[model samples]
Target: MTETTVTPTHASRTGGRHDEIRFGTSGSTGEARHWFRLPHQMEREVELIGTRLVGPVDRVLNYAPPQHLFGALFGQWLPRIAGVPVHQAWADPFAPLPVSPGERVLAVCIPMAWDLLRRSLPVLERAGSVVALHSSAAAPPTAHELVRRAAPLLRAHEILGSTETGGLAHRPLLPEGPEGGDAGPWQALPDVSFVRDAGAPTRGPEELVIRGPRLARPEHGTRPPDRWATGDLVEFTGPRAFRLVGRSSSLIKVNGVKVHLARVDEQLKACLPQTECVVLPLPDDSLAGEGYVVFWSGRGHAVGIADVRAALRDFPSPSQIVELAGIPRTPTGKPDRSALFAEFAPTSA
Candidate 1:
């Protein structure tokens, strides 16, 4: 894991002297990009989130590191705004939560933390009320069961955003059935709005152009753009709500057929509930111009390469199937795609 260093610099703006906070991207896509934000801008985010997502709370248990944007917002700022004491003892993935019997606890977590917390159900059940905040990735099926078992006592919410865009949208994590959870369409934040990219096709999923107050300035210290064109594709469901179609970069043409790696990953996850899988695109010399490989880990389960092939038979199968002891992940808990490519991608013979 590489360390991200944040250097706060002072800048003289129109109204007052404001300090800029630097944040490093997760580097899941490729090289990390640095972005800057003003303290007041970040405060506005804290205010919006504190008013919308966070309600009255007795204490906050922060599982995310404060260096990450999500962590800083919920873990550092939200607690201060709520005037509540926060405990970081639960930072360790395997540590037990500090929830008391009657406290209304706000648990700020990343996607990976949910699985660890689910294992300590006996402790979580003791809380009077639990508002679990999830971000950085989609919550797994285990999170749904965690909420179900703690029913009437726990409620979970997922936030959608990135390092460049502070916080764009949010949705309640609701149980669909006995099987898994549904993070329905994301609703834009009060300060955020979206438009379809001009270059996008008229008929289908379009790229989202985000207009918001929380947009970060480029690392070179220029004014933030009025509207930031994002690489994510979405289908608008309402005036301010949309269902994510997938990332533009994740949609690739394989053998002249379009394939969405995120969608394929979702399918594989549903089929192999006990296994962790990642599907990554690879270059091909064939007319297709692109190919993909599936990497999976059984997590002590009996799943095998043959099982993965059978699951993906109906879809465009991968050119290779590689099993590993575990999938590589960024410090922020996203699949380390760049690292995976460097390690597993074939070299020129």
Candidate 2:
């Protein structure tokens, strides 16, 4: 009898094996966890997202950080699954991407990146090959205007979704209007379904919940529900369309009146032109609860506490307003509300 030797093939150097999927998650309670996704699981995610994101002749350029879920799936895995040649820009998107003009280029960038591009509109206009600009993290309306003016062919889309659920929906940033607008309904890709709260009313402002094939399994020691309550509050504008109101966690009570932060944010932006503002709740001892505080970021803006209070007259009265050189933004460009409150809110001794 002859003994035969078998060689073991090592895992793919690109991280885990094609069969083993790795996911990084920060749960609703704000705990970080990682899980291994079976080959089939990852394949489903690719199938669900690829059809929506890629085109027959598209070439992707990703500047999103790979560590985050949106960035990992769309920026890294999706291209591999779709078999498209992606140009991973060495330079940050907040800065100019390393590539020059080329045909059929699909650009995925954050709002800050778009803002930078807007600042250099003349240079962007020269990159004629740019076709689509899909933005997430945060919506940059001003930058959207710049893109429209500089590159007519470039379409800007604001995608909606989070770590727990992948890119569940998208809205258009250009040709802004109600009917047949570029922003499509907040549609589930294929196998995904929105879980509604039975206790709540049938529609409008229901807790945004999710259940789908790609829905991640909860980690050990966590009382994970099969369906994820997204913590987002959404209103159904149409049968399939929804407008994100704000996070349920972000809801604050002022003088026994409930106020949504996003609503206040809208009022502030409407009142203070060209200036960006975020309303945060500060812990109050006298109130035996929390009070409102606002932080605004912009240049050449004369927004004052009085002006802000006047603007918000029709809305909830905020406790105070502080001027900031720039808002402390998350890596993805959304305001870091907690950080601001922690640093700025006066401590009661």
Q: In order, what lDDT does every prediction score?
A: 0.75, 0.59
**RMSD for each model, in Å, please?**
3.4, 8.0
Candidate 1 whole-model C-alpha lDDT, 0 to 1: 0.75
Model 1: lowest-lDDT 10 consecutive positions: 1-10
lDDT (Cα, tens digit) per residue for candidate 1, span 9-55 = 55524332357777777566547777778888878987877679777
**Strongest candidate by lDDT:** 1
TM of each candidate vs. truth: 0.89, 0.79
Residue 211 lDDT, candidate 2, scale 0-100:
73
Could you tell me the lDDT of residue 229 within candidate 1?
Answer: 71
lDDT for each residue of candidate 2 in 154-265, tens digit (9 for 90 to 100): 6655566655555566655654422223234565556667776567776667678877666543434232246767787888776556777877876877767888887787
Error of 2 at 349 (Å): 18
Top-scoring candidate (TM-score): 1
Q: Which stretches of candidate 2 lie over 4 Å from their true place?
A: 1-20, 25-29, 35-43, 90-102, 119-136, 175-185, 221-225, 283-286, 347-349
Scored by lDDT, model 2 comes in at: 0.59
lDDT of 1 at 5: 35
